[model samples]
Target: MTISSRVRLICLTGALALSVTSLPLSWPNPALALSDIKDITPAPPEQDPPATPAPAPAPGDDEDLSDEAFPVIPDPDPLIKPSNTDESDATTPQEPAPEVIYDLEKAPEPVRRMRQLIMDAAASGDIQALKPLLDVGANQTQVPLQTSDQDPIAALKGLSGDDEGQEILAILLDILSTGFVQLDKGTPDEAYVWPYFAGKSLALLSPRERVELLRIVTAGDVAEMQEQGNYNFFRVGISPDGRWKFFAVGD
Candidate 1:
């Protein structure tokens, strides 16, 4: 080739080398450019900051009420209309007063005679004196003794602490002295029972009635009878016809 053409070709080659050397070593990648674009884009409008959870309720909140917590309501008083013009006038039901008799003169002739006879026998202080009066079979005086014993005198002795039965006689006198009540009036069972307390309720006893009872027995005895709801002491029962119905203890 000619020298001029060779020199021109050499200058062209050196220019191209200098231009390439002046450029940056790292080349811009297409994938890196796309990643940078994604990073810069605004995040989808921040979706209303994920709803915050509601605060918990305080203690005893939203609980059911118990039956015990409610106040008790009492039943209303019964309706009572006033009998008189006065609104405060109220009448309450009361129990009937018991019929009590202290005098023996009010009794029939036969009863009085029989009572006198028994009193005389008891005053004698001899247990045998009562045997004649109690001799009638099936109609004998009903003494507090076992059914196996048929003899009234022996039964009296058994009841007495001593062999002569003076204690039983004393008890008989004490029983006959107390107030009496005539039960089953006009009926076949009509009889005068000594010590009216036997058939009467201890709870309903008046102050005077209690005094009469204390005459024959102690306060402790009345208290015990009150607890038991009945009298449990010796008593005598005589029919209107003067027949001795019973001479026994217990209700």
Candidate 2:
């Protein structure tokens, strides 16, 4: 073979190989790929679904806050109130008292008997009879040195400063004028004479006068013994309990 012919045949073969290799690597137009994307499956929706949104609450609804939700509370001290009430109930008001009245007519029996004995002695001056009577039972009542009209006890009260002896003398005179007298004895069945005098000559005298009169009576002095007999029927008065003795001499 000739050189020129063989060179042309080899060049032709090389050119064919070059063209084949470059053709598959060339870029296509974007407009031409739109149809191809439409045909594709969209990649199966990205595998995970979207998260669900939370629901909204209703407006204006009120909440229940009742006692069943809590509990009852009690007082720590209960007795204090009742104790105060009891103290008030226990208090009570007191009543006032009444006035008293005295009745002398209702004087005790013992005091009456004592007064009677004194009256008898002053009236009779009967020494013998009084001795036997006093032996049985008698009581001499003490005579105060003030008049009943003068409030006896109050008049003789120490505040008055009156001599007790002088007041006592006045009392003896008053008693003699009004208090007692001895009756005169007479014939059988004769009515009694109201002499208003038995033997009162020695009745109203001081202690010294009484002693002198007693001596005169004992000696049978006619002037002193004329009014009453010398039998000396004077009182030997004693207390009801026999606690004392008294002698009244007769003229």
Candidate 3:
């Protein structure tokens, strides 16, 4: 039934009850009236306890009270981003190309002597002596053509600055003394080695590059400590089979 009808029925019931209670015992059907009662609605759920107001403050008290008890917490400072500019600039470096490992103690007399010659040339600013030594482990085809002078040392010496010449020779000596090289990107039988820095190609070498050449050889080095022969920028190439190809130093 509609809610209004139900409410009316309830009102009528209440009225009849009141009237019956006031009626005298002359009524013939009082029991029948109650027996016919129908469709009584359930009692409304108990109402929540009335919210109590906060106790009034004393007349002399300094602090005033509130009806609500929820603490008024202050908002936190705006979230801040940490300054990580230096950390961000500290990017993870690329893994180094494998080096040529050399053992001077066990090296053959000729090899040791060759290493010494290159070192001496570099120390004395004489590229002439280091010229032939450069080709020891290198392929002939990779050598640059000299139109006027076939003497590799003289040609190299004539071409380089004093300081750069030494640096170039030092790098070559390091390569010549290398024991083995690793080509992470190449297979066991075949790997490409950039004797010069990949950043500096043969066609584009500066006068400072001296007689150094480009991709042609591979040879890894031997060091008792990690930082002994480490370089941030250099070119040391070798064949996958452990042959020296080209070697150069970078700025």
| Candidate achieving the largest lDDT | 1
Tell me each candidate's TM-score: 0.59, 0.17, 0.28
Q: What lDDT tens digits, residue by residue, belong to model 1 across residues 1-251?
A: 89999999999998999999999989886566654665666667656778889777779697555669976688887698456656456566665655888888898989888888888999999978887777366776788677655577888788887888999898888888888889878898788988788778888888988998887779999999999998898888899988988888887
Model 1 TM-score (2 dp): 0.59
Local accuracy of candidate 2 as per-residue lDDT tens digits, 1-251 = 78998999898889999888878765685575655666565566465667787555558655545678866576588655565666778867653221111231232444335444544643553322223333222333222334534433343232222543233223223333322221222322221111112224334445654453443234345345545533343222223232223333332
Higher-lDDT candidate of 1 and 3: 1
lDDT (Cα, 0-100) at 83 in candidate 3: 66
CA deviation > 4 Å runs, candidate 3: 1-117, 120-124, 136-138, 141-164, 170-180, 184-232, 238-244, 249-251
For lDDT, candidate 2 versus 3, the one ahead is 3
Clash-forming residue pairs, model 1:
none
Taking all chains together, the TM-score of candidate 2 against the true structure is 0.17
Predictions in order: lDDT? 0.83, 0.38, 0.48
From the highest TM-score down, the ranking of the candidates is 1, 3, 2
Q: What is the lDDT of candidate 1?
A: 0.83
> Cα lDDT for residue 71, model 2?
62
Report residue 116 deviation for candidate 1 (angstroms).
1.0
Alpha carbon deviation, residue 35, candidate 3 (Å)? 14
Which model, 1 or 3, shows the larger TM-score? 1
